[model samples]
Target chain A: MSQPDPLADFFAADAAPAVDRGFRMAVMEQVARRRLRVELALRSLATLLLFVGVALISPVLQRFAQLLGQDLSQVLLVMLAAGLVAYLGHFWLTRKPVLRLPHLRFF
Target chain B: MSTPPTDAALVAAARSGSDAAFARIVDRYQGPIRTFLRRLGPYTSDADDLAQETFLTGWTELRGLREPARLKSWLFSIAWRKAKGEARTMARNRQRDHDWQEIRPDCETPETERAIALHQALAQLPPDQRAAVSLCLGDGWTHADAAGVLDMPLGTVKSHVLRGRTRLVEILGVDS
Candidate 1:
């Protein structure tokens, strides 16, 4: 067994100091607010994407495609490459993420 | 009162959008998490706010946690980050206070007075060492667990605990 700290008894005695019920309620309220915000953001994004794809751009898209043929392909290739790199990087990061916390500095 | 559900069970329920399940998590962890934040006192001005932020992050990122069994360590990790993050916020919000260094714990008789003095001494350590001590000593976590929560190397955590523990013992002058 590892050598114990002399303060262990003190710590055990003090571990469960009183918690504020207000704090608990506040946390739950924030959780509800946050879930609502996320739902709203998703709905907004979905509407924006739907409008862009179906309502605003689809009618005039063929004219823009006609305007730049090979350049568009080059641009598409670059975009695809960037997306692939981002996906791979995210994959690499999520692997073995147990110890990867933000940098900590002591003053 | 009924025994609280295991963290893994609570986490699984919360991930399925059960607000009450997550609220139970908040109630279960609030004490130790707040105590850790308070004992790591220099880093956060409002332990309650930082603790709230930790649980809020937990609630929002429920699905991302791979192992719910490790939820205690994971939540502590979040609280550590929130504390560090709030330091930057506090630094921006107000003129930094340096008076904690000048605080001399009132030397008095009785075990309670000595305990208060010990806490004061603990608050006076460097923030990183205080964090290591708070997790390892105050909370009874292992050095490896402290290292994981604080994101320090295991060896570094051991040294921090050793130094912090020595300092606390010296300040308290407890017969060890």
Candidate 2:
């Protein structure tokens, strides 16, 4: 006859809980949120690059506009300011407080 | 009717960014992963969070997994690491606060009472020995397979299982 082992019996009888759809849904939701964050980050990087490219070429464009009797610096300044505000606002609304830079850190 | 795809096939599809394939993988492995974490000691309260982190890490690092055939052991390895990290973090927190306490598992019934006794006995063991017992004796994993998951040597795993079981039997025997 087999020996009675309570330890083995205890382990053997420990049934796993039934499959929970809620758990899967929670995980999938996290995966979707992560994908969205990556997409937003990539789009933000592209926008920043576009802004830098525009700023780099602005001096040349301003010279052309001066010859045409017009000033372009004010408009470029306004566009740059708007982009900075939008970027800061997005960062403020979405990112965790810990992710903020030291200057902007809010504990 | 079609047979379900194997874990390797699911892993390949997941690495290709198929959400459906990844969900299938989560559904397939979540039970075992969660159960293992619950048995892993002290952090049973964080079992769900730990399991979610394991799957998330698995998803992010799926492409880095060299052998698709070893997905089960790989996921278990991730679970073990996550549990260990959580334990360290909790230990640090516990030290900071003299009043720290682990969140107790629900124990309203006779069965749960017995489970609580087992958990208490298991907690008395060193962490590695507890894990060895949980993997080998509790989950019925082979010693070699458990060693692979734990990254311990075969002989060490065997020694841990033997000693852990003996200690557990002594503890539970006294309790009963």
> How many pairs of residues collide in each model?
0, 0
TM-score: model 1 vs. ground truth: 0.69
lDDT of 2: 0.78
Clashing pairs in 2: none
Worst 10 residues of 1 chain A by lDDT: A98-107
The superposed Cα distance between candidate 2 and the true structure at residue B120, in angstroms, equals 1.7
In candidate 1 the C-alpha lDDT for residue B82 amounts to 84
B1-101: candidate 1 lDDT, tens digit per residue: 99768999998888876778877888888999988987765433377778888998887777889999999999999999988876666456433334544
Task: Please report, in order, the local distance difference test score of every candidate based on alpha carbons.
Answer: 0.77, 0.78
Docking category for candidate 1?
A: incorrect
- The segments of candidate 2 whose C-alpha lies over 4 angstroms from its true place after superposition are A1-5, A13-15, A54-107, B92-110, B174-176
- Tens-place lDDT per residue, model 2, A6-35, is 686666444346466888888888887777
Give residue B75's error in model 2 in angstroms.
Answer: 1.0
Task: Return the clash pairs for model 1, or none.
Answer: none
lDDT, candidate 1, equals: 0.77
TM-score of each: 0.69, 0.73
